[model samples]
Target: MASLSEEEQQARETIRYLVAASRSVPGGALASAREDWRAQLAWWGSQGYHGVTLPPEWGGQGKSFLVQTMVVEALAEADANLALLYEVHNTLHLEAVWRYGDEAQRRRWLPDLLAGRRLGGFAVTEEEAGSDAESLATVAVPEGGGYRLSGVKRMITGAGWYDQYVVFARVPEAGITAFVVEADTPGVGFGSPEPMLGLDSTPVADITFEGAWIPEDHRLGELGQGYAIALDLLDGGRVGIAAQAVGILAACLGRSLAFAQQRRQFGRPIARYQGIQWMLAEMATDFAAARLLTYEAARRRPEGERQRPLYAMAKWFASRKAVQHALNAIQIHGGRGYLRKTGVEHLLRDSKVTELYEGTSEILRLVIASRLLNGYNWDSI
Candidate 1:
């Protein structure tokens, strides 16, 4: 584990207790009413989770990203999906405001968001664009004093339920523009939630913007700054996801270690078997290295130096290891791990998405490679 300061250790312990107190099995919530999950999210955010790294003036702890990461890792140990909701809401939405929003705009929105009174979401992904910014299809047409935006954004995390969304659209007069789109906007329609493998409590859907009129005051940053804002969000999102991967790995290791000691095979605990021991050892080693990389990325993000490549590296390595560790966790548990009630399978399902979401593994690899080819020197690499 990375060297934790006294405060970080306390943050971890506090979040662990809070998660345990408010957390419930996501499986049951999936079958239960939506309020079951929504209420749990509210309770979780009330613990200062949603604003882990936000400014103190907005009811946040004003902690560093590292401290926020530790809290995320701890909460994810109990509920990864809930952690996902908090991560996107903080890193993607609130961070955007802190980075781009004017003082008046911040005053208008930050309090509710930081207090978890209103939910926030990001809507930028499109079918055609996927991970390629050059293929953006959403458009913002200038009107009297605002913009008429039209586009379809898919795979939005809080699509049908969020109170607000920071959406990206191509501006006719400039390049890409970022807008704070309220849920109540006329012509702003949400498609039915799509069924997902994991993170069942968090809904993802397609948002269709059909001539949605947005005031100029709603624009985040400035005209033609949407692409940069989107990239900025992804950088923070990657760190959050990396911390999430660390949490998954930590949970997997803990579960596997406990299972290995308790379960028996051939009249002996599986932990006594060399084969199982090897798997456990490898899992621990890989997790340690990934955690180190994740913490380093989190630490460097505030410095603003080559963060894109560093965060990409952390996300790529940690995300892949999370999936592998979860798979090993299930294998060590034998047949029982495959069962839904065991929760190991849930980890696997959740870990797989870490590879595919945020900045996808393929995109990260390309980013690293491109950066390297452009003379990013690293003798260590």
Candidate 2:
């Protein structure tokens, strides 16, 4: 195993404190989880841990990608909901502005985002177009000095709650273009929150843009660049999801092992049974491998390497492993796992969403296949 550096060690300590704080909160479900996230965000901002990845010009810590990975892993181990919030805010919203927005746009938004005064979200998913993102029908027509956007974005994380959204809409002549739209803009309305299988604490809803208008300066990057931005954001978000899976798997394994060691069957602890021992050994192996793959993807980011294949592989495998491990944990607990009080049931529900979001397992396989068949050099392997 590799040793963690001084900074990484400090980050781990911070995460331990954050996790302890989260456990002190009263409720165990998603709503309470989101509230806990907000509290942590405020604390992180006050502690100067907000802008660890942005440029110095943007009031950021100006740290490297490795630091971002460390922070994300630490947060996920504390609370997956908070980790997802940070991922979407930094990688999708703040990074988009930094990477593609004009000078004025960056100056206007990056400060609040990095300061943790504003929350950001990316609006790309639609009811008819989930994985087939390019098939979106959202239209942004030129109107006077700006554009009028009219469409619906479904299943948007932080939809109604976020302060701002980076939206992608199709233009007549320029093709798909990205825009920075405020949540309170005219004609922008949010639907009721959707009842999801998991991650319910991180609010998701349908956002309707009925002729919402924004100045031309709000455009991000060149026209027809929305697809590129979306892909890039997903690449980063996938790694965050993989980290969440690792945390969940660790929790599951710990609980299952404790149960096996205490619960007796036939006047002997279940941990003595060969069948239970084998199950635990397999779970531990899966957890270790998944963590390695996720960290490898994180390390590749700073080198300007195209890690789409590795990112997909890690997200797919980690999510699958998390789901399977949660089920096995439930089986080990027998009937107790079925109850909400045990909390294993919540893990089981949450594990499924990791596979469904950030590109489904099937979509990730296709991405990996395309990269392999394109004749890209695999010398790094």
Candidate 3:
């Protein structure tokens, strides 16, 4: 991995200490963040994490994308749920508004977001449109001075917790379009959070838009541009997910190394054994490689179209390694790792979702294959 600048190194250290301190409470960081999410959000905002990549004029630190990814990795190492929420809010919502929203919209939204008065979410996936995102069942019909959105979006992070959402719905003649809808809109309703195996700290629910009225100004970008905008947002989101994976992988290696050193068998520490040594070696290698892939993807983000496949490769490989290392960590811990109290199992659960979202492992393979078949030079990326 490329060496971090002095500023980046300082930022990483600061966030790592902050998160480690916050997670020191009972049930660790995940439980604390989950139980008191509002407070956690406010804390993150006060620390300037919500705007790490935004311009200074917008009340942000105006840091580079690499710095933002570094912050995310630190958050993930301490708390995967916090990292997931941070990634979704910054990469998907804040980025969308900053890059696509008009001046008026930015003035209306940026302050509250920076202050933690409002949290942002992106709503796009539907029950039938998980991987095939374009097959949206949500529809927005033109009305007087606005549009009426009526459809359901499933698996939305912060579905009820978020103050506002950037919703995507198919228009009669405009195809899929994006709109910024306040959660309290007259027709917006939310279902109960879904029960999941991992990352339980992060809430996921379905949103129902029963003819919600959105003013013309709420529409993001031009008509028929939602698909492109969503794709662009996903590129950034993929990089964030990859960073989160790197964090999880780091945690897996750290926990396994400590366990191997202290764990004794046959009158000796397990770290002295060849089998345990090999597992630690592989886990360490995976952590290093995933970090490099994620850093490369973040560095090349400005290349636009060329970076999509790089994002895919980084997300895919990093997430896969994270899951593998999590399992290995558990094996190294034996009975202790399998138990929930150990907290090592949580990494496995959190790592599995990385492969399924932004783009699934199956979907990412096709994306990379398409790039290779197009005769693009793989070395250039």
The lDDT of each candidate is 0.83, 0.80, 0.87
Give the clash count for each candidate. 0, 0, 0
TM-score of 2: 0.92
**Top-scoring candidate (TM-score):** 3
Pairs of residues at least 3 apart in sequence or in different chains that clash in candidate 2: none
Write one digit per residue (lDDT tens) for candidate 3, span 198-236.
888788999999989999999999989999999999998
* Per-residue accuracy of model 2 over 179-219 as CA lDDT, tens digit each: 99999999999988788887758788999999988889998
Best-fitting candidate, measured by lDDT?
A: 3
TM-score, per-candidate, Cα-based: 0.94, 0.92, 0.96
- Judging by TM-score, tell me the better candidate of 1 and 3: 3
Output the lDDT of residue 251, model 1: 92
Give one digit per residue, the lDDT tens place, for model 1 in 214-321. 999999998888988898788878988998999999999999999999998899999999999999999999989888888888887785536678889999999999
Q: Candidate 1, 143: how far from true, in Å?
A: 1.2
RMSD of each: 2.3, 2.3, 1.6
Superposition TM-score, candidate 3 onto the true structure:
0.96
lDDT of 3 at 147: 97
